[model samples]
Target: MNPCRPEEPPTVGVEEEYFLVHPGSRAVVPASARVVARASAALGEDVAGEFTEFQVEGRTQPCSGARELRAELCRVRTALADAARAEGLRLCASGTPVIADADADVSGDRSGDSTLTYISDHPRYRAGVLQYRSMLDDFAVCAFHAHVHLPDRETAVLTCNHLRPWLPLLVAMSANSPYHRGRDTGYAGWRAVIRSRFPCLGPPPYAASLAEHERLATAMAATEAMLDPGMPFWDVRPNPHLPTLEVRAMDVLPDVADTVALTLLIRALVATAASRAAAGDPGPRTGAELLRAAYWRAARDGWPGHGADPLTGRVLPYAVQAQKLVGHVRPALRAYGDEDEVTAFLDRLASRGPGAERQRARMAAEGRLSAVVDGLVRETCPDR
Candidate 1:
């Protein structure tokens, strides 16, 4: 457990992406709102709806670090699972679920939206509809979002600033969107590209300070490009409603354990960045160029690609980048006293096998797209 000190920082929240499957068919089901209505008693006034019908999200009670975050996720996943099961439904956690049929529309049903029958109504959703209507015509996507609390707006801004270059690293580390529409999309995180369909919802520009962040947000809002601060779909972004940094790039992790590992890694990143900034170190030398390289790298090869050097644009296979990033963030990992957690969880991910690689291999052997998706269903949620 991460011992929470009074000065150890304030609040942290997590958002989860879940899908309902049609029982024996194991295909997508439009049962989110139905399950949500069923779980409201258990959710007990604590939850938020994601952009799609298939996605039901929950925000955790704020916390200081990873230990608390894990507990929160377990609680929410359990509740959701129980509620969904009661309705003869099962929940799936993957970037994209395997489909036997294409009738499932992931992008919000505009008709559903027009009637205000959707789950949540943040301005972000409204602007997203206006900006990406073309791409979203009949598409539906699902993902998990993790929002970590910072002590102040400045820390949030600084976290966003320093963490930019490594956004791709985070994305790569969590890539699980290997298969889509019954086919391997070739991209490690097709979901990233899928979600990028929204207008004001891509990566944020390089901002030096809180003032600059405000300026960027103003420009986006004024142009009516994005709905508001809720947009900006950077792999790592600042959350306007709360004093936290939200990571929007990861796919839904396979299991509670893997989700715990990913959560620990993210918390370590934010804590290290925040602590360094508070002490005046300003974090690492990551810049837009290097960051863009990381983004493209993950969008392309996921965990296998080598990280690119910010200075020379040279790629240092993960073998090389691992040394630098681990060395660079070691102090914070040590400071957070999460070295054991990081090592334990990361080793499992490294050895347990990467999802995308497994997906591609499965497709080669199975020679069937449905088989690939079925393999994924087995991978993400196994019936014990």
Candidate 2:
């Protein structure tokens, strides 16, 4: 779409993964097939099953503004929650299940004598289980992915370099998974920690051009480190099938307002990057190691804590980084008429903390993980 001109904000879409939880026990249940079937009847292909049977995902159509996106997200999430309720389950938007059966075996004939349960009956997922084996044991984490349309693959690849320095800030702002397997992980976004176990996980490497990006993706696929060229597991990358650069660093947020806020911010970040690239500004050349360190810090600390600036490798408080991000993207946000909504969302987050902190607060107040799951289910699909 003309590569994010100042007058034209890039169209964006979001994909959110959710967990199906038993309402009483608060345990993740393998009910995605039934829940997705019912939800798809109402929401069409926008709702679908994820890699694991206990997880489902909802996708929003490309939207030009925050209001449209928020409506679409609410519609899809409501449909899913209704469907899950119909089947005696609750839809949870947390990054990880509050409680899970850790010893539960992968269900599917592809994994040998295991029963036909847990894993979704997909060829790719089956192959993944066969290949990764034990690595897939605790692989039920969910994430929020935002796709911002770019002019072309080349531009998308270039924009990724520009977007790299801010990945940690995004992680800190969107931290939602604070607990895993019924116990507090002591990290804000434990989902990030879970994802890092994969071969090509974490922040993407700097690429001089689209060709370089393709070469690395192809190599990863050839080595069987990834399921395919499309699955790099990087925090950010040029989406293989879409003409958009996707940000996959954030945990799936329970609050719809937070989701809309993050998506708009992502669009602004991409627009700002693309405009700078057009003006002959080469983006930050942050090293891979420094980026990883910064990512780890964000996952551990969330916000209002210590974080490192990937650009200069300078450790700074997350509050400072958050302010810097808002300042950097303010021009683009204003151009898109999204400054007010985004700013308000950020302020609320600063005042009340992100989903991770809220979830932790619930746990502390009720003295049970079930309370955290209940809070997640409630926030996942608030009344319209």
Candidate 3:
């Protein structure tokens, strides 16, 4: 049914995208090339370019435990932040930058900031710009991507198939991109909607066997509709460069600890699904159309808001879905020794709410998106 047989425990890695901004004004700035040059010189290849010149990404080596992953994230964030500061810019790690349109106009009018205009200078990125044009321009959003190693392509497909239903709940938990183009976008995670604009995005079709998976994917790839195999842009997919299943649903979290927490949950989910597969149990049978609708609900109204349960299709409070998810993954959490940390993290998140809520709270109280940016800058790097 699956391609790869059991091998060893999977490793975890994280790739986080950040906004390069003026520390004083909190405006997104197109200084990533300079910052990346400095960061790569000091921190090596883990620091790299994103879709646009206003964004930079940091990746970590495959790690075994949450503690190890946490330490690496802390180091990577510190190094990148330092690199940005050295270039007279700051790196803010959130799903979307909080720069008001007025600030962009001022910077654009003054220095030709090109905050929203400059695409990354890579060949593929340029190709994408030429091909997508306006669609590409509308997508300056960022996200936190997590990769969980699978034994081989077969297992990767299995994990991705099984993980489909969980995508919406995770999106709700990671919702952070409420503001876009300087105003509230009316969606908790606007990045999700923007990303779904790609023809090859959203949930992949279920593959009864590895042969079916390969056939479907090959056919799609042959059309050249997408940039590449990885371009499908499904919320979860087999990594193009590694033997892993990458989860891309979660928006970039403001806190490094929260990032690690979500990473742990992702790994646990994969492990749990793999075990079920081993026992000859297929995962949830949610239809692709329903999955799409559920994702839309989560993106439009994250956390505590009503969302359709992927398993039952019943509209329920997000809190109910979250609890059910935790219960479903309890065995994996226990096996991975992540139960305590995850429980605490969930409690904290529920107490304060997702980044979108926090941002709106700041806006409501201060009546200024600038203040939201100020708070984001302070919380971008873990206290060090």
Best by TM-score: 2
Q: After superposition, how far is residue 103 of candidate 3 from its true place, in Å?
A: 9.6
What shift in Å separates residue 329 of candidate 3 from its native position after superposition? Answer: 1.6
Clashing pairs in 3: 3-154
Off by over 4 Å in 3: 1-9, 100-117, 222-224, 382-384
Q: What lDDT tens digits, residue by residue, belong to model 2 across residues 1-384?
A: 665476688899999999998888889988899999999988898998998989999999999999999999998999999999999999999988889865544443445575456788889888887778778877888999999988477877788899999999898999999998888999999988887777777788888887898889889889888777755767788787788889999999999998998899889889888877766676889988888889889999997678899977899988788778889988889989999888888798889889999998998899999889989988998761
- Stretches of candidate 1 off by over 4 Å are 1-12, 63-67, 107-127, 197-199, 281-290, 361-384
Which scores higher on TM-score, 1 or 3?
3
Q: RMSD of each candidate?
A: 3.9, 1.8, 3.6
| lDDT of model 1 at position 180 | 73
lDDT of 1 by residue, 228-332 (tens): 554455566767666678877777776666666666567666776776666665545555555555666776788766666553467766545544666766666
Give me the displacement of residue 263 in model 1, in angstroms. Answer: 2.0
Model 2: weakest 10-residue lDDT segment is 103-112
Q: What C-alpha lDDT does candidate 2 achieve relative to the native structure?
A: 0.86
Better of 1 and 2 by lDDT: 2
